[model samples]
Target: MNTHFSLFRLPETFELDNQILEQRYRTLAAQFHPDKFAAASGFEQKQAVMMTATLNEAHRVLRDVIERAAYLLKLNNIDADSPEHTHFEPEFLMQQMAWRETLMDAKLENNAAALTELAQTINQAQTELHRNLQVAFSENHLEKAAELVRQGRFLQKLQQEIHAV
Candidate 1:
């Protein structure tokens, strides 16, 4: 599979070194910079632009835990974001409801402190899911990984809601 990890010459795993990724991204960005291809033929310039876009998207997906998990699921022939496959565990569904209620209450009360606390809680949950996702992928548990990806997406959306608050 020609994944972002492949593009960076790295193994396809959840564990990645941020520093190394940053350095590689910079190096690749420089080489693919559209300006570098300006003096080239029209076809070459177009190809450079397309590669640059792909590089940028790869960098973004590889850098974000949630996005990376989803991408990996896709690589495994699973679409984690598919609406028809929305089957979250009951416990998680209950927690999601509670979190939403808490967010709603905080918004109504204009409680910035509560919102901040909620964001931290969601971040911690995201971290745990990230860890679990790594383990799932390592064990070749694609189904579990897909579930975690969907859960992470929920928490990510909650985080965005908190930010909007």
Candidate 2:
């Protein structure tokens, strides 16, 4: 484990046990929450805010299955930063391109139904990607997990585009 986990003081124990995580999260939140420093010195309050922000970020990452898996992979010395680690299945990439085309077509035609369909498709992909992420993480398949993260990023981007319409 690198200093990244230490930066947030997040547990480095690969324990996915939710009970332990929840307790740790709550303890950190309580300790760093800005409200708890309402009467502290200015510097203390600033430090509390910074700590709280870090704690909140950690909570967000830990609470999300995909993010948690990605973090764990990083801890395991996996080169998740590069797509070179895994060859993304070409068929899936082509499918994603088709979906992107659909979204573009929908936007150009101002078709509400098409936008809705695209949203549904992206949402389904997100679900599948999350499931894959869990499996990849549990099996220590870092390359596969990284590919899923990339796919998830595109799906999320598409989701935002749909909403912007």
Candidate 3:
């Protein structure tokens, strides 16, 4: 895997400075943009295109908290993307189901206030999970980090569902 942190000259951590990331992205983008090599040889242009694509992908993965965490896990030989790697605790699973039911109920009743409140609640949970994830990473607790990532993914999906409704 290409190290996105290396590409952006950033540290390999969930906590990042968005301002510095944006600046690095823009600098690399301008340097690797295909248009800059439009008059160059065909091979040079193709290389530029590939580099530009890589830069964009690296920037995207590093900018998002979830993706960045997953990438870090991957670097540590953890298969975070695999289904078998995700094993949420029973309590968390039950809570997820209850949240889903609440979402469904709010939708059926056309309750905008309820949906808004649910979104807020989920967002708070997501924030807390992120904090836990940071500690997990710092402590070298890959299993705990992976579990937090799974919960974070659930909350993210729930947030999207709330938005769709």
Candidate 4:
């Protein structure tokens, strides 16, 4: 698989300038959009369609902090999705459980304020994790980076659940 960084002509780092990524995506999308190839031959049109798909996938992956970190780990020979890599610190696991229970309690009580506070707490942790991920990637700490990405995934799912509530 082509690395999303290479596809977007970006450096392989956890910290990315989102504006640049978006601009590159727009440029690539405009270049490969099917309408631009409508007058071309069948093979060319098909190629454009494939390029468009690739561009979209690249944009989607690179635009998200968690996916981008996971991608960086994969590029560095770490499988973030592997079972071994899924192990989080015990404290983190306990914290996640506490957050989940709090969320449940908030929902059961129909307390929007509590839910909002929990969401904010999760958001703050996510932001900090993103910063830590940037440092980990910069220092070539692949294992640490992978762990951070796993934590990020958990937080993201929790955030989604919060939204659902």
**Highest lDDT: which candidate?**
1
Candidate 1's TM-score: 0.95
Displacement of the residue 13 alpha carbon in candidate 4, Å = 1.6
lDDT of 4 at 103: 99
Query: lDDT by residue for model 2 over 93-147, one digit each (tens)?
Result: 8987898899889999999999998899888889888877777766777777777
Q: What CA root-mean-square deviation does each model show from the true structure?
A: 1.2, 3.5, 1.3, 1.3
Show how many residue pairs clash in every candidate, following the order shown: 0, 0, 0, 0
Against the hidden true structure, what lDDT does model 1 obtain? 0.91
TM-score preference between candidates 1 and 2, better one: 1
Query: In model 1, what is the error at residue 90, expressed in angstroms?
Result: 1.1
Error of 2 at 116 (Å): 0.9
lDDT tens digits, residue span 53-162, model 4: 98988888889999998877888788888987667799999999999999999999999999999999999999999999989988888888888988999999999999
Model 4, CA-based lDDT = 0.91
How many clashing residue pairs, candidate 1?
Answer: 0
lDDT of 1 by residue, 75-142 (tens): 87899999888898999999999999999999999999999999999999988998899899889999
Error of 1 at 101 (Å): 0.8
Colliding residue pairs in candidate 3: none
**lDDT scores for all predictions?**
0.91, 0.75, 0.89, 0.91
Clashing pairs in 2: none
Distance from true position, residue 102, model 4, in Å? 0.7
Worst 10 residues of 4 by lDDT: 79-88
For 64-114, candidate 3 gives per-residue lDDT tens digits of: 788889989988888676879667789999999999999999999999999
